[model samples]
Target: MIVEDSAVVRHLLAHLVSRDPRLELAAAVASAEEALAEIERVRPDVISMDIRLPGLDGLEATRRIMAEHPTPIVVIADAVEERGLRISMNALRAGALTVVEKPLGPGREGWEAVAEAICTQLFIMSQVPVIRQRGIGGMGAGPGRAASARAGVPPFSRPSMVGIAASTGGPPAIARVLGALPADFAAPILLVQHMGASFMEGFAAWLDGLVAPRVLIARDGMRPQPGQVHVAPGNRHLSLTPAGLLRVTDTPPVGGQRPAADVLFDSMARALGPRAMGILLTGMGEDGARGLVAINSAGGITLAEDETTAIVYGMPAAAVRLGGVSASLPLDGIGPRLLRAIGGTLEATGGQ
Candidate 1:
């Protein structure tokens, strides 16, 4: 279903959806109310949600939809508008799968890429299974706990940094894990989330609002402090200097990811060695699998989100197959388990 107030954009989106052989337009409505009303009847496998809508904005509509009838929703948002971007991120927090920049029109520059990304995200996200969530900012929907342990592997005594990577269903998953941390979390964190360059700042802003750590776009030469998160800037690979300061570089995209999780994990392997903790979360590809192995080779702690909780099990499963992970855990268990690891109390969970 397509929900938008502008008739032009609505028609444009409808055209885009109709032209794609992989997608079928269930319904096109001018308001979220109409979407809510017709959802059960039309029963789209996926929905392209407009963040700016006439009455019942996309955020609230997403919350209600997830609560009542669970379905994968991809948010279509204006990339540059502050209010619109905030709403877009909040819509993700409300259980929308991912956000894509909306195509203004065929004449607009870069309109082709935006349009393609929308259809692509829709097609890919539709395959993901989403469940009914209660209330807004849906939290604690973990599918219980599962852990894998390798025996005789000793835990770390003092970790200096945390590295995390995610793609696909990353935004909300990142929010859930980061929000669970205490304000005084002992280590600084480095995050690499695969998203469009235009949305990075707003993504960081939204993360800062939800997480205990103070989140900021990573900057070159800046030192990360405890209880803080440094997210790789768009189109830049984030790493750490031997001096423990941040390094944002434009050398080249590793495996086609500028802010590749591999870059961060590899840097941690070099800079912090055994004191680094590397986590690979839900993503569409294998960008972080080798990097997690690099950390494992350095004797650092490594974790991958288990299949029980990952929206897309690609990245984590890749790491597991490559023998890089030390533990595989459910979404809800990551925070407490990580805390225990940092607190020097966690036992081995085999993934080796």
Candidate 2:
């Protein structure tokens, strides 16, 4: 289904969907209200939604759809303006799987390529399995949780920094983890989320609103501080120097990601050693597996989201298979676990 208000853009999207052999358009509606009302009948495997709509908007529609009928949704926006970018990010936070820029207008250079990109994204998103919106709470007690509590904050280590990596169904996952943290969270956090370049600024802004911690786009020479979360900018590899200052690199993409989680994890391992905490969240690839291994080998604590709660379970599962994860926890448990680890008391109860 395509939910876009503009007739021109809706026509373009419908044309692209029709041209793709792998996709079939279920419904093309002009407003979010119409899409919501007709969604049950349309029953699209995936939805292509525009952020700006006539009524209810894409973000609210996404939230409602995910709550009632979980389906993968990809938000589309012309991200040229800051408002559009912000709205796109809001859609993602509301459970849209990914955000893509709208196809350029006719006669613009590379318009065809842009349309193809959207088609490809739609196909990819359609393949993703999504779950209904459940509140952020520990799913259930498992052996992993017991073992994590028993380990009791690995001897003689104190976490100085936190590193997180995610993609695909990441925005909401990141929000859940970070939103659970207290405002006085002492360790600075570094996040690498694979997303389009146009969405970076707005993503950071959106995250700031969701979490208690101050969020900023990581910049070269900036020093990360406690109570702040630094997000790696799009298309740039964000790493930390030995002195703990931020380093944004234009180096070639590692594992096909410029802001690869591996790059950030390896750098954090080298810089903070046993004082670092590495977290691999829900994503679609193996980008963070090796980095989690590096952190584990360096004596840093490594955690991966457990399969039951993860949106895709690919990245975290890869790390678990590689023997890199120190503890695999559900989404809600991660924040509490991290706080305990940081406080040097990884007990079952609230030591942190």
Worst 10 residues of 1 by lDDT: 343-352
The residue ranges of model 2 lying beyond 4 angstroms of the native Cα positions read 109-113, 135-151, 344-352
TM-score per candidate, chains pooled? 0.90, 0.90
TM-score of candidate 2 relative to the true fold? 0.90
lDDT of 2 by residue, 228-293 (tens): 899999889999899999999999999989899999999999999998899999998899999999
The local distance difference test score of model 2 is 0.85
Candidate 2 lDDT at 102 equals 92
Model 1: how far residue 195 lies from native, Å: 1.5
Best-performing candidate as measured by TM-score: 1
lDDT of 1 by residue, 212-233 (tens): 7789998999988777889999
Pairs with backbone N, CA or C atoms under 3 Å apart (clashes), candidate 1: 148-349, 148-350, 149-349, 149-350, 150-350
